[model samples]
Target: MARAETRTHPDTADAALLEGGRVGLSGRWTADQGAAVEDAAARIAGSAAGAPILVDLSQVSRLDTLGAWVLERTRAEIEAAGGRLAYAGAAPEHRILLSEVKLRAAEPAPAPRGRLYGFLEDLGKRVVGAKSDLVTGLAFFGEVVTACIRVAARPGTFRGTALVNQIEQVAFRGVPIIVLISFLVGGIVAQQGIFQLQRFGAQSFVVNLIGLLILRELGVLLTSIMVAGRSGSAFTAEIGSMRMREEVDALRVMGLDPIEILIVPRILALVIGLPILTFLASLAALAGGGLTASLYGGMTVDAFLARLQAAVSLHHVAVGLIKAPFMALIIGIIATIEGFAVEGSAESLGRHVTASVVKSIFMVIVLDGLFAVFFAAIDF
Candidate 1:
């Protein structure tokens, strides 16, 4: 066997041309040679140039796994580029190392999705999420009912002080704003009704329109939306803060039910407070309507009062009041659910609080629509 020889630095590998288009590798081909081994491999591969090339390894003073893998990768690249590479005179150990160090081909990138596919995927995800939320809401409602039953069974377990405090926060402090908004809405409605009805020489009927609309729809609906935005958001923030601080877990450690201690009181407060607030809101709206009638419609107080009394029935008042507690329950449940879902970050708390308000207000409006359909179907 005629061995090929290359003059090179003893520590770093080098490649050189030899007889019969052969490439001879010399010096140490190991990790210690680092980039030199890779450069030598690159030289061998580049020298192939669409023709057969032989690599004579007999002159290599040392060989390691890293050097073998680099040479193998270079061979693959050259072969992929329509060139040929062959090894000769490699020792048994070098042959085994080269045989065992095959390079895997890179995987291809995924194809891009179209807009219709992306839209369908997003819609499916949201539909699944909404279903999950509905199930969670129903389960939480059951837990709340169970807690209420337990408190009812053990009257002493009820937190009267907490209930009163929450009532003060949710209802008493909320009175001025609720009253003012309702009054302004009522005046606007009455003014519009008069303006439109006067064209038909029936401006007197504005009193009837104001009475029925305020009592049957606007009063309780506005109050529920305000409460959802105001006290519902507060509930979520308070409970979410406690959740972030691990106080909920602490309550469980103390052998107390957090539902009874924290949730029931707030819910009870909403249930108790909402009706009173609704009644007050209705009365304020009626007062505003009466004032608007006196000033803008040129109707006397006595005549407005008579028309209102004759137009509105106890049935309309009952229908509005009937929806109040259910609306309160919906708001409380949604708020508490969002609160308990809070994670350990301030951002999580803020996100859940915002979600709580949005969900509560949306559900309240839906509930009102359902009530309207039900009451109309049954002739209530």
Candidate 2:
């Protein structure tokens, strides 16, 4: 057997060539030689590019797993550059070790994609995601409806305690902010209507404008938005955290439907709580309008009350309140769906909570528009 003779190339001490298209490797090539081995491997890989080459490692007196990894990486680089690599007379013991390292180090690289391809792939992914979201929302809506009917059938199964607790959470606790927001909104509406109507010598009609707009449109719309932001996000976060903790799975294992346990109470609470909240908001708004009328429009409280009574009928108030349950349904369903979709991570919880709020707000506005169109068509 011919011993592998190793000598440095004239120009590069780190690399050397030998007979029979063989590249000679020398030195300890151990863990401490990591950096040098890597550098040498790159040079060896470049030299072998576009051609088949043999590597003689019999001259490497001392070696380690790190050095084997470096060589394996060089072998991959050469193959990637359209070259074939062959080991020349590796020692019997090192052969098994090097083979094991090579097997472990042979990781596939991510395929390079073109800009257009990447864009199209991303677009496809988004379209699929939207479809999935729609399906999930519809399925969740159906499940909630079913749960409601089931619980309604068995009054004893009704979770009144949980429902009341949710009412306090999404409604009672939210009253202060709701009142403050409605008050400011009403004042703004009154001021704007007064300014505009005064120019038209219709200052008194500002009372009618505020009454119609707040009761028929703005009151419920603003209230729903606030509730979606405050309560809807909370629902998603709470449920999502439960999902991450595997409590939802535990409930299922215990033969309890998660929707019945985690969702129905919240939905019922919203349906009941939202109307109460909306009615209160409407009153707060009316009070704000009255204050604005007294101060900005130089109208008496009695005059404001008389005008409001004449302008806003029970029908207008009913229209706003009637929309509340539907809006609540939308918000609750979106929140619950987003929550249940949570993966096992805090980041997923945060993302789903945000999505719940956004989707709830968007759906509320859309539902409001549909109601407006329907009312107009029905002469309501």
Best by lDDT: 1
Candidate 1 per-residue C-alpha lDDT over 1-380 given as tens digits, one digit per residue, 9 for 90 to 100: 23334545676798887777798888889998878888888778777888888999998888999999999998998889898889999999999999999787878997899999999999999999989999999999999999999999999888899999999999999999999999999999999999999999999999889898989889999999999999999999999999999999999999999999999999999999999999999999999999998998899999999889999999999999999999999999999999999999999999999999999989999999999999999999
- Once fitted onto the true fold, the runs of candidate 1 whose alpha carbons sit more than 4 angstroms away are 1-118
The alpha-carbon lDDT assigned to residue 289 of candidate 1 equals: 90
Per-structure clash totals for the candidates: 0, 0
Query: What Cα-based lDDT does every candidate model obtain?
Result: 0.92, 0.87
Model 2: per-residue Cα lDDT over 1-380, one tens digit each? 23333445322224456655678877777787666677778778767748888888777777788888788887877787788888876888778878888844445998999999999999999889889988988888898889888988988988789988999999999999999999999998999889889998899998888898889888899999999999999999999999999999999999988988889999888999899999999999989989998899999999999988998899999999999999999999999999998999998999999999988999999999999999999988
What lDDT does candidate 1 reach at residue 48? Answer: 80
Q: Which ten residues in a row have the lowest lDDT in candidate 2?
A: 4-13
**What is the Cα-based lDDT of residue 289 in candidate 2?**
89
